[model samples]
Target: MVSHERENHFVISTRSYQADVCGKHLITHKPAIHECYGKGCDRMFPTISGMFIHLESGTCPSKITLKDVNAVVAMYTHHNSIIHSDYNKSLAAMLNREDPPDGFPFHCPGFTPGSLCGKRFELFSGLLQHCESRACNHTFGQDDGGLLSFLHKVLYSESALFKLGRLKANVYSRIELVFPEVLRDGEQEHLEALLILLQMLFRKLLDIIENVQSRLKAAISKHINYQILGLSLGHPSNLDAITGRRGDLSALAGEYASITGNEGRIAGPERMNTSEVFVWNIDTGECQLLHLFLEETTAVFEILSLETQPQ
Candidate 1:
């Protein structure tokens, strides 16, 4: 078999076989081996990228969403060059935005009903079908600069900030695992002040929260007419027990509500995940829990600096 084989021939092994005719081969590799810990998928990979790519491709039984992949990629501080930095911000915006519009709003450019490839279509899909028909030598697939490729580019650039604008962002890491560094008792003295600072910050935040909570509690008790005061599962994601409906805060919107013609860009409670805790604002009386954690600050204008922008 070796004697009859092509010079660079190498057999790629997996649970399923790939024909040499198509490019299913894993190109990036390393000397170290790693295993896919996904359920029933113990397939070994030559590099971490290979494992993530396999899982993200939906080939593994344990399916990982592309968004989850992007989230992890954004975590690596060194990967600011290739990957999207504001992944969270963009996703929050997209999720808040209405789903993609349906049907063609405008006519197909550079084509008409009288041309050799002239079948006018009002329905958006009818035009896609025409493109895929290849009568006009335009295809929806991997054809050079076609509809699919162009949309992929748009999603790449707009939806996320991949500098190259290529889809399927994977993270390459130098360290396999992290363990805390050990320090002797004498050496730990230098870190005591930092630990004390964290404790002070937590205590300060607690005091502010308690004061605000007391005010809100008193108001809720005084205003018995408004129903959302003590609703369980008040979050928009889960159904409320008494109401048997997703708790929509927007129900409170009234004639005084500020109208901005631009919609979908404004974040809502619906964007909050099950794992996050929402913080209320005492001044605005509105919940803007868009960030993972609430940051309450008392910085004066005189103290303003680049580092104090979060305030």
Candidate 2:
């Protein structure tokens, strides 16, 4: 069960034994010393408030800024909503249609009740050509709908320092399973530290997604002509009905095919099976392991720098 406390801005999930604060989760039952749920900074705090303050202070080696945490919280709030889930399901259903049109299915906010420019297509490639030839300003926006919208907002917003943090989190989460094991005691400690950092960043990204959703919902309710509202309101097929534009997934599939020279196969957003994608690629796995080691080293340097600084 989920219990929300508006006064303290907390959400408690009994099944998960987790308490959500500002979009991030903390394991409860021990108030005096709180351990950060962030991947790398599992450090204990004297109090719950102290842990929150530490996260906000950006003192953690992961370099997770206050803005980063806030963005994550916003993202988490919207993504967990029932509306977003329903929208995704509807879009997926449309894509699975047996007899799709000739040009790509596109959603055009510019198309109101009567507009000649709002035309549908079956193939996304055709839609792209048409948009370019006609100088139309249409863009793709429905890979993960709400999540993508949140990312766009974060990208264009003023808080630019942690712009790549979310992307990094995505990459790490996907590639983490293939991480190499270490035999030496020193190497094992380093590996553990690196994994923790990755986890911390991943959690922060989730929170940001939630926070963005909440903001988007509020904005949609208040403003009639918000650009995001158009994107948010229209289902995937709505664009196809008005304008022949392809969703982000189809476009990505096409791009992947072109790059990989794979015929008739498209890459979906689903997580790749580790055995199929990485187990045989020893070199690639090693590279990821090395990358994590480098990150750990950088974090150590930052911590040392902070320690030696004159107060």
Candidate 3:
């Protein structure tokens, strides 16, 4: 005896069912019946009496109520706040201490296992000073070790999230191929929401890649500029000695040129080939022929020291 409005809320309504009231419309000689109103409970029966019997039997699936969703969100929010606050307090306490004594090596707080450069500082102040460099754009407590640990605990370690990450690439590809077929007869609103979510995920991934690429490009450019500047100031007398070792230098320079698409050549006093090398002595304000062989892939520099020990 339920009205059409009540029936609409309890069961999925269609255009054919609009003309009929009490949700007892006949479909192919069998009476079309209402489904259970509970979330995820889709059992149907030809008669209201039969539907009621099933509800009373307590075999229906457990409904996910709004209260349950709210409780989980609140619990996670509170936990995140507590952990973030404690980490911030500890960082502030560590930064307040006086600098370590001279000659004592102090490990830089920003240097984590994941950092590209594993550089240490001679003093606490030096470590703090190194943090100012853009190349080492890392924070002490917030980013050094805390962010990854927190993400591992909350996301990576979670079974569902880990599986989602692993399968996301394949899922996206499959969805691209099958989405139109699967959603052809589906609700327009649901399809639109799914599309929007997919677009957002793709855009976020693109943004992360773009950011990393830009930082890498800048670092490479800076390193090359420094190398070129050092070569420009080398003594002319050492040019012959450097030219003799051109094969080693050319190999290193060719690799750099290939990666950056920039000509790696010396343009000082006279243009030198890739095989020529240059060395600058900071202490004596002089440039000598070191004939250094640089391995581009590993970035290891082999220097042939020309200093003669007092006999």
User: Better model by TM-score, 1 or 3?
Assistant: 1
How many residue pairs collide in each prediction?
Answer: 0, 39, 1
Backbone-clash count (model 1)? 0
Please report the TM-score between candidate 2 and the true structure. Answer: 0.22
Name the lDDT of candidate 2: 0.36
Give the clashing pairs for model 1. Answer: none
Estimate the TM-score of every prediction. Answer: 0.22, 0.22, 0.15
**Candidate 1 CA-lDDT value:** 0.30
lDDT of 2 by residue, 1-311 (tens): 24444334564544443212312332233355546533346688644335545655667554544444433333334432212232343343332222232233433222323554554433323333333332344443435544434432342221222223323333333334343342333444443444445334333333333344454345443212222211112122322333212223334334333432353221223442212221112223332333333343243323323323455
In candidate 3, residue 40 scores what lDDT? 39
CA lDDT, every prediction? Answer: 0.30, 0.36, 0.30
lDDT over C-alpha atoms for residue 135 of model 3: 31
Error of 1 at 92 (Å): 3.7
On the 0 to 100 scale, the lDDT of residue 309 in model 3 is 14
Model 3 stretches with alpha carbons more than 4 Å out: 1-219, 222-243, 248-311
Which window of 10 residues has the lowest lDDT sum in candidate 2?
A: 272-281
Q: Among all windows of ten consecutive residues in candidate 3, which has the lowest summed lDDT? A: 300-309
